[model samples]
Target chain A: DAGVTQSPTHLIKTRGQQVTLRCSPKSGHDTVSWYQQALGQGPQFIFQYYEEEERQRGNFPDRFSGHQFPNYSSELNVNALLLGDSALYLCASSLRTGDLMGTEAFFGQGTRLTVV
Target chain B: DQQVKQNSPSLSVQEGRISILNCDYTNSMFDYFLWYKKYPAEGPTFLISISSIKDKNEDGRFTVFLNKSAKHLSLHIVPSQPGDSAVYFCAASVAGKSTFGDGTTLTVKP
Candidate 1:
């Protein structure tokens, strides 16, 4: 089965500008979660979407938002980007139906966003 | 505050030796733990996971040990190889969200 996929493998955005990154969940998975990884840091949870609605969110600012479509695809939009926004944006997918243990997450290749 | 932590920023071990990566979590409610390996300019990949009920889990030469009482976990790789070098991340899930550690860079010298 095809694994999680992310588009625009690389992108450069200017300060005060907005950028939108896309992701497609793995086949047979419904839940989509977004994460940000800065240089030499671990991935931090941005938010999660289920049933086409946001189910959970992290401590990120309001400038960061996302949307999940009926097809289980998702998009992350960051407005008024700052140089610190330059990092790897990751998308993870998991099946939420089975037991908690079975709902293991699978990550996409990730989109490298560089805010200039 | 960071809930999960990997104190060692980097580690180096000779090939064929054992490489141990350590992690600690401050959240007591975390019930699930996982380790992921990441390459340069790539996303982190799932390496292995351990549940709170089990103290240890092994798959091939890689094994994961969890000490709930200590709120610590470790990933051990036997006969470490050059290909095994990467940035290792530790994560914990208490409910709907999972928290990650800063990550450790493990290098297996060939």
Candidate 2:
């Protein structure tokens, strides 16, 4: 079985531009979440998607948005990127049980985003 | 305010020694805690977790201890190996959302 997979291993974007990162969850998983890991810091929760709808969100602003497709894949879009947006974007997949989130998650290698 | 805090930025230990990474959280509602390890250029991999109901959980050389009253948690690696050297992160979850610490870089010297 394949683990979580992300696209465009690395990317470079200019300020004020937009970028979209993609992720395919592990097989038999129904929930996907996105995180941002800045240099020398731990991954920060961006948001989580379940059942094709956003289920939970972190402290991120409105500029950061995400979508979950019917197939359980997800896309994270950041608009008006700033220099601080440069970081490693990680995607994690888990199997949600009832009303509780999965305790353990499988992560992808992540897409390194550089805002120039 | 940062909910989860790993005060130690890095830790060094000799092989076969014990390695302990500490973490504290400001949120009292968090009910679940976990530890994850990451290598360079790779996303963090889940190591172990303990619910609020349990004070300790062990898996092989890795053990996680939670102190709900203090809002603190720790990861212990016994007889550490060189390969175990990596960034260890402490995460806390509540209401389906999880928060992570800055991570502690552990170096096990052989």
Candidate 3:
């Protein structure tokens, strides 16, 4: 079975430009989350989407936004990208249980974004 | 403030030995802890997890131990193999919002 899938394995964007990364969650999954992994560091949570609406967010700024489609796919948009925005954009999917008990997250290969 | 911290940036263990990676957190609200393994040019894969109510959970050769009072968790791999070498990340969550630590790279030598 195809796990979480992301598009445009690698991308290059200039400063101040905007970019959108896409993700299709694994079959039977309802929640999608985005994360940024900088060089030599672990991933930083960007935000999470559930039922076509943003359910939770991390410490990211307004420039970072996301949308969850009815099919449970997701898009992560970063506006006015800076050089620091260059990192690996990871997409993870999971089954959301009401208790927020933290179920296992299945991740995609990730889209590497390079901001010049 | 960085809530989750992996003090050891890297570790090297001989094959067939036990490899233990440690993590600490400062947030009291974090009740769930997970360990993820990442290879180069790939997203992290969930290795194991432990809830606050449980101090230990084992899956085959992999085990996760949680210490709520200490706000710490650890992942142990027995009989480490070369293929087990990778970057390991420790993550803590509260209400499904997770905070990841700077990963620890493990190298298993044959």
TM-score for chain A of every candidate model? 0.95, 0.97, 0.97
Tens digit per residue, CA lDDT, model 3, B1-110 = 89999999999999999999999999988878899999987889999988889999999989999888888889999989999999999999888788899999999999
Q: At residue A14, give the lDDT of candidate 2.
A: 100
Residue A23 miss distance in model 2 (angstroms): 0.2
State what share of the real interface contacts each candidate retains: 0.57, 0.71, 0.76
Best by lDDT: 2
Least well predicted 10-residue stretch by lDDT in candidate 3 chain A:
A95-104
DockQ, each predicted model = 0.63, 0.78, 0.83
- Angstrom error of the Cα, residue A29, model 3: value is 0.5
lDDT over C-alpha atoms for residue A76 of model 1: 96
Estimate, for each residue in A6-98, the C-alpha lDDT of model 2 and write its tens digit: 999999999999999999999999999999999998899999999999989998999999999999999999999999999999999999998
User: What is the TM-score (0 to 1) of chain A in model 1?
Assistant: 0.95
TM-score of 2: 0.98
| C-alpha lDDT score of every prediction, in listed order | 0.91, 0.94, 0.93
**TM-scores vs. true structure, each candidate:** 0.95, 0.98, 0.98
User: What is the per-residue lDDT of model 1 for residues B11-35, given as tens digits with 9 covering 90 to 100?
Assistant: 9999999999999998998888999
lDDT of 1 by residue, A2-111 (tens): 89999999999999999999999999889999999887889999999988999889999999999999999999999999999999999999888745833468999899
Give the DockQ of candidate 3: 0.83
